[model samples]
Target: MANPSRVFAAVLPAAGRGFAGNEKEQVLEVHTVNRQSPGDRVREVQVTGTAEVCFPADRVSVCVSLGNSKESVAEVLSSVSRRLEYILQTLRQHGVSDKDTVVRRYLHRAADLYHMDAEVVATFSDFEKMEQVCSVLLEKLDKSVCVGTPQFYHSAGCLSQLRRQVCVSAVENAQQKASEVSQLLGQSLGPPLVVREEETKEWRNEDGEFGSRGQGAALLSHLPHRPTITASSRVSVSFSLRDKSRKQL
Candidate 1:
């Protein structure tokens, strides 16, 4: 019997050859190299793996708008300023720091009415304290002050950390999948050859399939019961493989 693990070279004619000079003018080409045995073939497997992580929202931003209309610009400014001061004082009394508050004042004349508006923004880590501040503004403060629903989002630092952790988990999942596939093929999983991250998607679990709140009005009524933020990471990984027969030998 002949050894199957042999490599041979063969010569063949090139395509589109015609007689140019004398008889039997042709072109010779070398092509079609194949391994005599299946064991000589190189193997690589590509797998895509995804991982998702969920965490509760850690910070909240409370937005409040106050406006006053008066006969004189000075009077409207004074009233709005006083109300804004009171709102700030109330926030401080509830443990909100100055660094966490933002205030903007605007004045304009509309149809002989001196209009003054103030927008106040504050961020809080404690939901109870935030709720307290909002309640006080709506109940104790004058009706001139308007409050908008607080928008909920995860902290930037928290999201950054989650992305890193989820990417690692996704790669691990890819490795596990590759190992399973290698086992099924009776091959040993070798070192990874390539790694590529596909994408990372993050959203609130309460949003359901609505995606972002800015997408449409259809998701306006759904409320998040869990205040949970979910993140998913996808990765494509290529890994080399070693034959089981070689390992056994």
Candidate 2:
């Protein structure tokens, strides 16, 4: 009787079916046989495939703040309100919807003076518009207002899509590998017997800050090291094999 393990191992290429790399792509073939009877033998090939996908940060949030102090509460409120309203109006005029803006105010009396501080945080999907809005606020408000640096990050929907894309790519890679191995063994590829995602990982760039000023400063800041997120998937697939000679008969 033939040794099933040796027979299976010798059928596939020693170099494996796909290109080898640093965990970016991997392929391994596995075979199992049923020894219940020689005529009842079952053969299958299993391969592991890996893939990675990267995406840049899609959303940015900028905070604008102003404060004032006066001997009376009414004076402090009046002074702070003027700048706060101006900031809100500027955001709206730049096509920023109310739902994307958050407003917060704080009031307290320190010794003899009443102090008021207000902040407006706006989220933007359009980078160009964000840059324009930031420039307008900083130029008009001058030293009286503070516009914070832009913070970039990916949205939940973007992350969801990335995961789906990486997984599908990994599966396709596995199928390709299986087909190649099957052809090399003088057999035809059949329907998948099993498909599973073995592992998944995600990471982001270490430096997430973009600080510079220029014509395309907003877009340029992402160069060299943008705040990008990468997702990787490892999938295991098992495909049945059909003998060409038997199928022809």
Candidate 3:
């Protein structure tokens, strides 16, 4: 009869056949059979997507100030109060609500003179109206009133909408990439298996220009310099892959 060791060596692969003098000590590798059900054998593809969105500043706040000095506290108060009332009245006439206007006053004694300083900070959604109001205040109050430059910013609702929009755009971009990949692999793209926002970034563009120095940037340079906030989002998404032939069945 043929030797059992020689029979074992004949069945072994070429790389595993060279065991001399230590046949009993040599180890054999056994691969476990995969018993996973067909339903559990799902194939997935993962892709990363990113998007950036720029939003112009919408709301504006302007400060209007007045000061008065007199020998008596009552005189100073009367003088400042007259200008303050006029400022509030002007804002109201321009459709500014009381909730959007804030008034602050400070009283101090400089040497023997009583001094009072007051200011009203008003927030406006209408830019044209804001410009008209500023012009009216400067013309009527003249040097008595000082109107600061308008500070532009995005409202809470605007920022919330921006964040949501950027994230959704990133996800859509990822799905597009996955679809192309599936097509290349001769497969059909199914619904998403997993989706996660990997990162988010926000920054202010003080110069109000895009990052690229291309033609788009040159065109934007000629536009009004309204500082903008840019938001970016990156997402990782996994999509299920289906055999195109299986769909017909």
> What tens digits encode model 1's per-residue C-alpha lDDT throughout 129-220?
98889889999885868877777677889888888899999999999999999999998999999999999998767653344657564555
- Clashing residue pairs, candidate 3? none
lDDT of 1 at 122: 95
Model 1 bad stretches (over 4 Å): 1-45, 53-59, 70-75, 108-114, 142-144, 154-159, 182-190, 198-232, 240-249
Candidate 3 lowest-lDDT run of ten: 1-10
Residues 122-194, candidate 3: write the lDDT tens digits.
Answer: 9999988998999999999999999997788899988998999999999999999999999999999999999
Q: Model 3 reaches what TM-score against the true structure?
A: 0.76
Better of 1 and 3 by lDDT: 3
1 versus 3: better TM-score goes to: 3
Cα deviation at 54, candidate 1, in Å, is 5.0
In model 2, what is the error at residue 188, expressed in angstroms?
1.9
